[model samples]
Target: MTRLQRLVRIAWVFCKYRLDIFLPMAELPAPLKLFFLFAPWHLFPKGSLDRGDRLRLALEELGPVFVKFGQILSTRRDLLPDDMAESLRRLQDNVPPFASATARQIIEDSLGRPVTELFAEFSRDPLASASVAQVHAATMPNGRKVVVKVIRPGIDRVIRQDLALMFMMARLLERYWSEGRRLHPVEVVEDYQTTIYDELDLQREAANASQLRRNFNNSPLIYIPAIDWDHTTKRVLVMERISGIPIADIESLRAAGVDLKVLAEKGVEIFFTQVFRDSFFHADMHPGNIFVDASNPADPRYIAIDFGIVGTLAPDDLSYLARNLLAFFRRDYRQVAELHIQSGWVPPETRVNEFEAAIRTVCEPIFERPLKDISFGHFLLRLFQTARRFNMEVQPQLVLLQKTLLNVEGLGRQLYPELDLWSTAQPYLENWMRKRIGPSGLLRTLQTRLPSWLEQSPEMPQLVHDTLVQLRNAGAPDRGDRQAAITAELAQRHADRRWRLTLGALSLAALAWLGAEEKLVPLAQNMPHYGWALLALAGWLVLKPGRK
Candidate 1:
């Protein structure tokens, strides 16, 4: 459908669902307020269903893109209240499945073979379905169990249509909204576009799965299914079929004698390990993408699937984030505020004392509640609300991490009510911080960076010579300096030799310090003094009168 028609359809859905009440009339522009007053949607009665249900139904009526958007927003528990998030979470795996025959046709065409020839047995019915794809059970030619996933026919066109509308809306919001610059609506849409397009390509999903499997190949914390590359393609995927109890099925897990507490803690550990140690993590960890392998009821391991989205952190973001969380865990609001300004995520001119007070106002009251009663979701909700006062913009790169973390927190709370989230995560953050600062971290840093420093060292003398030449040329008189230049040239020749020697000494000092910092120099002493002496000598050579 064209974007205009899609927009009309969206407006219809919004009207039918009576979504106008969700709008903030007080904050809206006069034009918008007037438009809403005359909007045809006002003809309908106010919805009896609550706000959350109204939103959920509106998204469901809109189509797959809206459904998937709701699914993502559902995981962001921190952004929504409990009832709203719960209502939207139903969109996670409830996307209607496409016809089995159509899926079969896609598989056949993608693999260039008949289903019977490729699999020992293939099931027509889908075992699971999602916005972009659906999966069916099969037995491979090697007699191994597998799942066949086929992309929804023509989903790309549908996504692109919706994405175009999203971009339009985002641009309008960025242009017209009061807080547009701070919120960065267009950039958020851009990141969402990149993420959704990546999901459209099954090969990228396969690679993501393989890398995650390698990240936790043998560890018992989680199990990732193996892919069958021989049968995988851009439109189809065949992978090892795994079976486990649905993570949300608490009663079944209890019946199976699983230790819920241990299971919950392991989930937390697995998430931290992926983020800090592996630096790679499954971004979509809602219960729909996670299952509990409770074969060992005493120590249940998680079975993860659906690697369409993943996240990684830059080394600096990772460090600053971990420190920020650690500070929060310790109730050190000042440290949290300092880390924000220090990381350049928050504005430099922001007063740290004021920011700290704002954070404390938001967080200190939560301490009154028992550990089990405190919600990470609520904490984040308030913290972000406070962040707006300081003009802190959204970090697009952390969007997936934030969503995945909310999912993890929700799952942990579901699995075990008394789970102490702060205690569970604090050590991981502390350990991660230590690893980036301690002796081993320093050694690792040198090993990775020393070569580049050495490679650039030889260019220093030439750089100095060029700078001196530029200074001499810039300092030259327009016409009269030439008479004195002949005499100065003779002196300059002598000065140049000393200047070159000093430059050489300075270069040596750089190399020596690099080695000394890495501790290659045994009992290294006065390395800074040596650098100062070299710098001092270079200054004297440059500043001394040139025999004129």
Candidate 2:
């Protein structure tokens, strides 16, 4: 269908199901409200469903990309209203598969081999169907059982069109919504586009799967199925077939006598291991993409599928995120606030004390309960809500991480309610932190780069001599223009440093305010007061020096 026709079809589906009813009647513009009331027959047909249900239906009808978007939004209870978040959480990945003949054609064309030649058996029926691709059971000629995943035919055109609409909606949102600027709807959509479109290429997904599999090479906690490189192509992937109970099929898992608690705790470990140890995580970790092997009931193993969407944090982002998470757990609101500024996630000019106080208000209540009792998802939501008050812009990269975390947390909770996420994650993070920053990390880096260093050492003397000569010539007073340029650069750098310091101070103040709520040790409480008084005392110290 043409992009326009697809949009029209979506609109018609919404109208037929009365999706507008879910929207707040009073909050909408007067004209839109009036139009909804007066043009019910034209905009919404009779016997319509609940507005939330209708919206879900319309998105599903639209296509996989839109449905995937809905799934991502569901994780952001922080950004969305309660009703919408709840409704969107119901967006399932199960969609009708393309014809078996179509799947055959895609595989044959991509691999340049007939199905009969490639596989001993290729099932006509799909094992499962999702928005991005469908899986069909097959056996390699070598007698290895595998699953062939074929990208849905014509999905790219649909995704591009839906993405265009998403951008348009994002622009409208930024123009109209009160929270648009803070929420950064357009950036969020753009991030989603990059993520979903990347999933369209089976080659990329296969590589991601291979890397993750290698990371956990001999690990018992998680299993990533081997990719059949010989049969894999840009549009078609052949992977080792795995047999396990779906992670969400609790009844079946229970019937198979899987150790639920071990399974749950292991899930948390697997996530931390992937993110902190491997620095690569499977971002799309919805229940459908996860399974559990109950073969060894005492030691349950997690089986992961759908490696299409994954995320990695930048070094700076990883450091700041770790500090923020640690600070929040310790109820050190000031540290959290300072970290945000230091990380540049929030504007540097924000007052640290005020931000700190806001964070304390949002987090203290949650801390009153045990980590097991606290809802990690709700905690994030509240944190974001508090951040919005301080003009904090949403971090699009963190959005995927947050969504995946929520899914993992939810799955863990369902399997084991008493699971202490803080306890489970803290040790892993601490170990990672130590290895990342301490002597061990330096040693590891040295070891890894030793060969290259040895290879380049022979040329180092000449390189250093040449560099020193350039520096000496550049510093020569005969070059007055060079001196002037150097001076100007230094001055600009100084100004930038001052601005950064101011931002640092502001962030610190926000953190102090947030951390002050807990009965701080008397000394810590007096520190801020002392710091303030020292500013006043600085003039006297300077005057004394001047008089002397």
Candidate 3:
């Protein structure tokens, strides 16, 4: 169907669902408010429905792109009120599955092979279905069980039409809204475009899964199923079939004798490890995509599915982020405020003290409660609200990370109420911070480059000789005041080189000191009450205390 036809169909669905009744007519725009007085729009159902429900219904009615947009928006609890966020969170892609025959045809066309030849058993019945894709259980010739995921037939057309309409709306919003600059509606739409397009490509999702699997290979915390590459295609993915109780099915997990506390603590540890160690995280970690492998009830491992949406932070972002979290943990609101400005997450002109006060107002109360009791999602929301006061535009990417983190945090807490997230995460972040800013990191860098430097050592003398020859040939004798000038220049160069070498060596020693700190402490303890004399002897050589 055409785009306009689709939009009209959407409007009809909204009306048929009696969505208008849920909205407050008086609070809407003047155009919509006036429309409420007319025929079909005026025939509103009388009930207890709310604005949040109305918004959710309207987006769902608008079809997949709109529904997905709502899903993305639902993650930005920082932007939405509690009720609205709660309502939108229910917008799951539970639409009817496309025909199994059609899915087989798609796989055949994309991979140029018949289904019978590829799999020992290909079930027509869908294992699970969603708007974009559906899966079917199958087995390979080698007797390896796998699940084949196929893209829904004709979805590209549907998605394209809806995305075009979304872009149009975003453009209109940018043109009309007074807060357009701050909102950056066009940029938001652009980001959504990139994300949706990435989702459209199953290969990208497969690669993401592969990378995540590699990151946690043989780890006991999380399990990402292996991708069956030989049977996989662009439109069809064949992956290891996973069996676990759904995370949402709390009763099943409880009945299976799972240790909720250990499970919850593991969840927290996994998140920190992904963020700090891997730097790549699964951004779409909703309960539906999470499952619990309770085979080992004492130590439950999480099974993660749906790799279509993931997020990674730049190194600089990760560094700044570590500091940001540490600052928040320390209750140094001013430093947090300054960091935001320095990192350019917030505009530079924002007053540090004022921002600090605003942040303190938002965060100080949360500290009154235990860290587990404090909702990371809610805290982020309040922080964004405070940021909005200072005209700080939101980072669309960070919103996804924040949303996924909140889901993980919420799920963990629900499983184990006693889980102290702060306590579990604090040490991880602290260790990461120390490595990033301390001596061990410097030593690692030096060690990584040392082999290459050794390989190039033979070329250094020749390089120096060539440099001196070029300088001399340029005009050594003809230059006026040449000798004296060259002498002065050499003195300056020598001083500069001396300082550079000093700083470099100091950094190396600092890293070594950090590495040896624990070992050195014991050695110092055993130093026969004369450690001061040893230090004095070493200091005299390095510092030349006799030289003024």
Candidate 4:
């Protein structure tokens, strides 16, 4: 569709669903507010649907791009109201499949082979369909069952068109709305744009699947399908077909004698393992992307698919996040606040005690409820809200982590309503912390680095000697001072050389010390103070004059 036509359709959808009711009309421009007042949709009888439902419906009707947007928005429970977020969470990617002939054409064109030559049997009908791609079941000549995923035709153009509109809207919101600047609507849209565009590349998704499969190879908690790279292309992906009951089919699970409680606990375990142990997690883990292998009902295994999005944390972030979870479990709000500052998640200048109190205010009440009743997702939401008060800049990297956590929690609750997420996750966090920060962890780290340390050991003495020489020369006087006029030039040149040497030595030393700090005590409480002192000393030395 033309851009103008798309905009008109979007406007019609918005009015038809009366989505303006969700907006702060009072905060909008006077002209826009007046336009809303005279909108034709106002003529229709008000339905029983709530604002959230109306918004969700509008997005769904707007097409796959808007649906995807809603799905992403659903994850930001901290930023959205419970009802709105919950409603958006229900947004599913079940767009109508394109013609099978078109899918075949794309596959053949991308793979450089006809379907008959590529597979022993190929189904024209799609096994599943989504916004960006659709999957068709097929069998190889070797009789190996597989699925061929084809990207939607002209999806790139469609996405670009939709994204332009989104950007325009985001700019408008940031320009006119009071909360827009704080929310960073433009940045959010940009992030989404990057993510969706990445999704268009089937090769990247296949690689994600391959890495995850390797990470969980021989593991019983979850299963990832193997990629058929020989047939995979940027437009088409071929992978081993997997068959399992959809995770959302609770009735089927029960009928298959699956243990719901065990399933729920295992889900929590899998999530923590992905986040803390493997450090690579499938980010798009909604019910649709998950399934249950109930062959061994007592020990049900999860089957994961759709690896278009994944998340990882930097080492420091990983350590701090683990400590934060552990501290929260122990009800040590002070430590939580400290970790946030230490990890640079919150502004450095934030008052720890005040932040601690804010966290306690948000978290303590949640603890009053039974462990089984508390929702980790809601707790995180509250925590995010409290952190915002301290002007905590959102960590874009952790956005996927937060979203995955919410999905895991929701899946757990769905399987077993009385699931104690804390109990399931606490021991795992504690164990992870112990292995990461305890004596054993330290020994392992030392062992890993011992060879490198030894290799560099020979240079240490020379480094020390060079640093001392620089320090000594920085204070040395020019013996040519007897020749007064030339002495000044000689002294300046000498001072410059000495200054360069000293700064270089200091930099090397600082780097060495920082490396040691990382290996020795990654989450050390006093390391920041030591770092500040070093920085202060460097500043003084830089500003200090040489021998005059």
Candidate 5:
């Protein structure tokens, strides 16, 4: 459809759903408010559907891309009202599969082989279909079972067209809506564009699955199916077929005697492990992509699929995130606020005391509830809202992490309503922090860099001599007296370099020792600043004034 036609249809859907009633008419200009009065949809009687349902219906009617957008929005419980968020959560990506004949043709054309030649048996009917792709049951010649994932034909064209409409709408919202600039509608759309386009590449998805499998190799907590690389391609992926009950199938899981509480706790552990331990996590961890292996009912494991979208955090982000969560668990609002500023998540100029107070106000009441009664998703939402007052910019890289956390939390609660997320996660965070910042961690870092240090060791003496000479002669004039001054300056610089290096090494060693004792938690918390201090000191000593 043409962009103009699509826009008209969207407007019609809005009016038909009586969405105007949900808007704050008092806040809108009189002229625009009057436009709603004359809107043709007003001629029809108001339906029984609520605003949330209406919104979901409108998106579903728009197309697969719109439906997918709603699915994403559903995860942002912090941004939307409870009713709307709940309603959108039900937006499923159950689009009808494309023609089987067309699918077969594409497979043949892409692989340059007939379906029968590639597989011992290929199912014509799709086992499942989503907006971007569909999975079909197939078997290899060796009698091993697998699934063929095919990207929807011409999906890129459709996505680009819808994305153009989305961008146009986002621009309109930014221009006309008061909250648009704060929300950053354009950036959000661009992020979604990048994510959805990434999902179009099956090869990327295969790599994600392989890496995850390796991360959890032989582990009992989670199982990632093996990718059949020989048969995989950019447009198609073949992976070991895994059979298990859907994670949402509570009845089936219970029937199999799976421990719901343990299962729920494991979900949280898996998420933390993926985010903090491996730094690579499945971003699209909705129930549809998750399954429960009940072979051992006492210790159920997660079987994950559809790794098209994944997330990774930088080292600083990972460290700060772990510390923040640990602080939150301890109800250390002050530490949490400090971490935010230290990590540059909020502006450096933000007042730690005031931010801490605000966080306390928002979090204290939530703590009154029992662990099982609290929702991490809502807590994060409240935290985000509070951070906004300090002009905290959204971290786009962390969006997927946030979304995956919501999914994990939701799925955990669904499995066992009484799950103590805090208790389950606190120890994990504490352990991760210790391993990351403790003496052992320092030793590990040193071990990893030892080779490089040794490789450059031979040049160190020359480097030191050259640095001293440069510092001594930096502003010395070419004269007889200057020659003696330069020599004296060189000797002084050499002495200063030794002392500076000694002090720096001692400071780091002391820090590591204190970290081992857990006495340097506060120091570790402020490690970023200490790092900069060390760097500045090293630079100053290397260029400090000498006898000259």
Candidate 6:
């Protein structure tokens, strides 16, 4: 459809579902308000469904791209309201399969061989169909079972069209919505655009599978299918096919005698291993992409598929995240709050006591229940919410990680209701910490870098001599220059202190203004003015330089 026609269709869907509740009427532009007003859907009365349901249904009715969008949004409980997030979680990417003829034609074109030559037998029927791709079961001439994944025909054009509209909507929301700037609608859409486009490339997916398979070469916790590179192409992926019960099929898993408790714990182990151990994880671990290998029912392993999306963290980010998780497990609220500032996740000037209290209030209640009863996903949501209150900036890299954690935790709890994820994860993270930050870790680092240090050792003496000569020319280390350097360092420290005080003053001024404007009503009502004044006074004690 033309872009104009697409806009009209979207408008119809919006009005049909009464999704106008999402828009802040006063914030909308005049022309846009007029356009929606002229739309034809107002004649019919609105349905009895709640606002969240209306939003979910409208996205579902919009087609594959929007269904996937809703699913992505559902993962972001931190960004959306509770009702909306819950409703969006119900969005499913259950698109119908495209024509087998088209799939066959695309395969032949990508591999430069007919389906017959590529595989001894190829099923015309699709094994599964998702928004971006469909899989067909096949067998090679050597009788190796494999599955061929083909990108939907002409999907790129459709995605491009939809993405253009998506960008426009994101811009509007970010411009007009009160929470738009905080929610970062445009960035979210950009992330989705990158992800959906990445999924369109079969070769990338094949590489991801290969890397993950190599990461867990022979481990039994989780299984990633091996890629058949010989027949793989940009638009076509061929991988070893294995039969297993879907992870969501709990009844089938139970009937097959798979040990549910062991299976669930193994799933958690695999998740932590992928994240902390390997620093590479399958971001999309939804039930549809996961399965249980019931061949050994006593020790069931997870079979992972659809490696189109994955997450990796920077070394620093990974370290901080590990520390934060460990602190949370220990119920060290002060340390958790401190870590947020130290990691730059929260503003440096934030009050540790207040932040710690906020965390404790949100999290302490969470630990009151049994491990199986606690929702780690919801815990993360609350943590993110509290961080938002402190003006903590969102880490885009961790978004996928948070989503995968939710999936893994949800699946874990589903498989075994009494699963203590904390028990399973706490020790794993602690062990990782020992290996990562302990004396052994230091020795391991030295061992790995010793050879490189030795390789450059031949120049060390000359380098040292040259440094001494330069220092000698500039006067000895014990001379006036050294005292001058110390004096300069002292001056710099004083300057730094001065700047910090200046920043604190500005922050206090801002806080005073906010208080005077009656924005502190709830806070003042909760605490006397003197204590509230003290709290506002400490606002300037923020560690980081004041933000403009």
Number of the top candidate by TM-score? 1
Q: Model 3 — TM-score against the truth?
A: 0.81
- Better lDDT candidate (1, 2): 1
Question: Model 2 shows how many backbone clashes?
Answer: 11
Per-residue lDDT of 120 in model 3? 94
Question: Which stretch of 10 consecutive residues in model 6 shows the poorest summed lDDT?
Answer: 539-548
For candidate 3, lDDT tens digit of each residue in 112-209? 88989888999989989877789899998889999999988788898888778778867766665566668787887787778887887888889999
Give a tens-digit lDDT track for model 5, residues 1-548: 67678778877887778777755556668897898678787776779998799899988888889898888777665456779988998887889999988888888888889999999999989999999999999999999999999989988888888899889878877776776776777988898898898899999999999999999999989999999998888898999999999999999999999999999999999999999899999999999899999999999999999999999999989988888998898899999999999988888999999999999999999999998899998899889989988888767877889899999999999999998888888888888888888777876685466445434543555676666666656755653466756566566556656655654574467556777778777755775774656446554544555433
Off by over 4 Å in 2: 17-51, 445-548
lDDT of 6 by residue, 1-548 (tens): 88889888998898889777777777788988897786576765688999889999999899899999888888887688889998998887888999999999999999898888878999989999989999999999999999999999888988998999999989989898877887788999999999999999999999999999999999888888889899999999999998899999999999999999999999899999999988999999999989988999999999999999999999899999989998998899888999999999888899999999999999988888887678888889988988899887767889999999999999988999898888899899989989897645654565465445434533444454455546555766555566655554555455545544654554455456557656557655775675555444444344645222
Q: Model 4 lDDT vs. the true structure?
A: 0.84
Per-residue accuracy of model 4 over 42-124 as CA lDDT, tens digit each: 87666899988988988889999899989998887656788999899888789899999999899899989998999999997
The worst-scoring run of ten residues by lDDT in candidate 5 lies at 450-459
C-alpha lDDT of all candidate models, in order: 0.81, 0.80, 0.78, 0.84, 0.84, 0.84
Return the TM-score for candidate 4, rounded to 2 decimals: 0.81
| Model 1 per-residue lDDT tens digits across residues 338-404 | 9999988789999999999999999888988887788876688678768878988777667788787
Point out the higher-scoring one by TM-score: 2 or 3: 3
lDDT of 1 at 264: 92
Hey, what RMSD does candidate 2 come out at?
Answer: 12.6
